[model samples]
Target: MTAPVAFPVVTISDDLALATACARWRTCPAIALDTEFERVRTFWPKLALIQLCDGEYVALIDPLTISNWTPFAELLRDPNVVKVMHAAGEDLEAFLGGCGEVPAPLFDTQTALALIGKGVSLGYGAAVQLYFGITLAKDMARTDWLMRPLSDDQLRYAVADVTYLLPIWQDCAQALQQRQLADWHREDSEFAARRLQQQEPAEFLYRKLKAAFVLRGQQLAVARELCAWRETEARNHNIPRGHLLKDESLLLVAQKMPRNWPALSVLETLHPRALRVHGQAILNAVERGLNCPQAQWPAPVRRLLDVPNGKAAQDAMVAAVAAFASTRGIPAELVFSRRVLENLLLAIVDGQPYPPPMWQGWRRAAVQSALASELTSFGIALPDWW
Candidate 1:
């Protein structure tokens, strides 16, 4: 049986209450922060509530009632105050959308756990249970946070987010200090926070589409144009990009380079709503792509599995990273993910920059030697700087 714990909940509704809470929080050296939002059908997350705890004080600040964010924004920008969170990616997004800024000097418990060799992708509940032997109820996870007058269970769940986080932050900070990886955690947390706020340029977005590797030359250009148009349309309407047109349908259209409605109608994956709403716009994008100069065409993206000897090199690097991580007490996934290795391989094949930031900083000392040895064995030479 799980032991019941007391959480003194205080609701900050108006601007004055929120400002007062921020004033108190600014004095604390470290505080736990979390946000509840809804984003199921929209391009951006809808900010619902902000939860905060500083060991002794717990408060839920309702964004619906607060207008003046001057005090809270100052608290976020305060250098002395360290904001701690768990799996802060989406929460960071919520903060950016809500207040046009994100917390710096962030200490993400999930990232800290991975650096300590515990695990990557450790959810808050798992971390709490792992460290405190407490199983939290997740029944309120899917509740409508934007609704007026939230239920008791909803408010309790919100408080619980930051309540256990305070202790988890303490434990994680201690572990990081003991392992001498506090700087690494700080660097990664800042990078992740910044990355969450970045909007990838639409022109380059097609490179991330599924099966983009299959399209080349004019076909690739078409895919790029189509994706760029979809991105603009989605953002303009505040709907999901996928809801406008699925990737497979876009890819199919790109492959065929359809010029007319009849030609586009043959694509079974293209939804009827898209055809009725934006059919001519899609054809115009296709025409523009067809008329694009040869020099403007995007190069085909190559996957390691599709390229000769690429898979072997990737496997060697993966093994090297795993072996190095095992000895250094760092999670291998944290050291280098599959996507990172793929990007590294493409850079090497294209004779582009040898080492991206993934191979720099603390990671350079951890896995560089082993990875370099693997590449040399495969007859690949690193850039002079590498």
Candidate 2:
């Protein structure tokens, strides 16, 4: 903590160097990993550089030039070599899309720190300052990583991200072990990595649209159809989905289900470009949705969040779980995030026939059998098959 750590930055611009570094990484116990990617203009991120470190050495692999990612993918899949990163969701996305791999035995320093009760949601630079009293530069926040021949300053900034990761993870892991919460971090990392690695279908992307769940059967159908169409159109054109059609505008069209451009153009939410180029296609999708059979309508989007009972049942369940967690000294957020708890209530409200994560693995471990007993006391039973 007394000294600023320094290491030589090895730039790997070709296949040979990348292969060599991958081979070396496979032998290391753990490595620090980070990436720089361009995501401003496209639906999919364009990976620029991948930075890795193993305490003593740092390597910046140029993803722009390297053609064969097999070696790197193998290294990432290796179970023995832990990949340490901070807030790794987006990086995981880029890796799955670019390299066909998701780093296993992953130790996310951000998750680790939060699990150990060190910080709630700390960024890489703030974490470094808190743990080692070293302030990292922020000048490279929006740099054009896709540019060739990165400046010396950019390379330096990139390498600094991974250089301290190993030491920081070590400290956090030790803290977790001291508190007998090491298994908690492992559970979270594996669970998060699994979810990140899976590619959810774009058709379901409409579920994320604001207020999409509030629509009734036919209206929801139109929104889903429009959302799926926008997803496909955006990807085929390699442009941002909003550039093709905004979510607000899609919702407006879904509600109105206009049969012609003039009718569609009447909505204030419709963009000029969207109406000019894609208006007819949007109308076609809406017509199909309008004729959709009642059985074919999608489930009410997250309707449980607005359950009419003042959600007294849901409120009592979350409060019971919170009190139970307090007795076991588990961090309330880690046991089941606020969102997870809400989703669980939403599922129950919708009569979903399965148990949510809160009723399984880590949540059960933290609360013993109280969660189940609390629900049983309400005469509510989880399906046995679940």
Candidate 3:
């Protein structure tokens, strides 16, 4: 058996040390990277720790100690070197949001592992344990990486994360190549690279409350107006959107169209302060809902799918996809999961072109074929289903 490699923990304390570490990383062909951040109470994540390993050496950059970030940021933007991270979504967000750039030529080990049927969305600790039989210590997860005079144990744990990652990636990459699934890894990496721009408006700000769809056009108009008001209030206050008004409360207010402060005050879901401060505006919204013309109301909610047999056709397609996933030793959720499969089924029944399956390789093929047949049965032919 190959002896385990010991990782040297280098804390970047000066500009020279930081630059030297980046220079080493820039020359290396690929490096494993990870970050620690706190985001519980803030709009943006507070980056506390950054860990990088270039096969031979592991360097832990303490953000609290070093202020000059230009050297590290330049290395991050370098496209020649591949950056590897396990489950890199939030880390990528922090990097882009902080330094205004994301690393190019990025490889996500978790995605690569899933492509070869290792496990869907596997945790970093689990992946390392499975491949190396080395159980990683978890005590440093909630440690204050932002504090100075870091303990020896915390430094060792941080270094170990990326040090062992190099070997784990090599093993996983080899397995993927043997299975002819290397292209899947490439495509997934590309997909994750694009995730830096796919931010969506929060659902609470846009989606109508559950069962709010049952209301008439005028009621929906009221709901939309109230939602717009609440969204603006939440932003101006710099509080969570729900802190201003819950979706259910907004729906009820729109439905009832209360004519007076007393009537609105009776709403159980309304926050006491919201009623005290904006009760007049709430009444105005209710009045607008009551008087808005039918033609001016928001459009009706469209059904997701319109197949000939609807639910029956959806059931058949789902079963087919699930069976195909099982036969390949991959989890059915990794293929389409129940939620995405249901949406896809609805789109096919509605005569809409199927959306790209999130999974790669044979699983995507299985989902596409099943969806295509369902669409054809509804007299909708999709030539690009392949």
Tell me the tens digit of each residue's lDDT in model 2 across 1-386.
54446987778889888888889889999999999998888876778889999877798888888999999999999999999999998888788767878888899998888777767678999998987888899999699999988898898899888988988888888888998878878888887778774545655666778788767888888888898888888766767888878888888888788887778888867668767788888998999889999998877776553665525655665776778667756566767665676666565555655555446667666554655565556565555523
User: Can you tell me which runs of candidate 1 are displaced by over 4 Å?
Assistant: 1-5, 235-237, 265-268, 350-360, 381-386
Better of 1 and 3 by TM-score: 1
Using lDDT, give the best candidate's number: 1
Work out candidate 2's RMSD over C-alphas: 3.0
TM-scores of the candidates are 0.90, 0.87, 0.75
- Off-target runs (Cα >4 Å) in candidate 2 are 1-4, 201-205, 232-238, 268-277, 299-305, 352-360, 364-386
All models, RMSD in angstroms: 2.8, 3.0, 4.8
- TM-score, prediction 3: 0.75
- Enumerate clash totals for all models, in the order shown: 0, 0, 3
| Weakest lDDT window of 10 consecutive positions for candidate 1 | 350-359
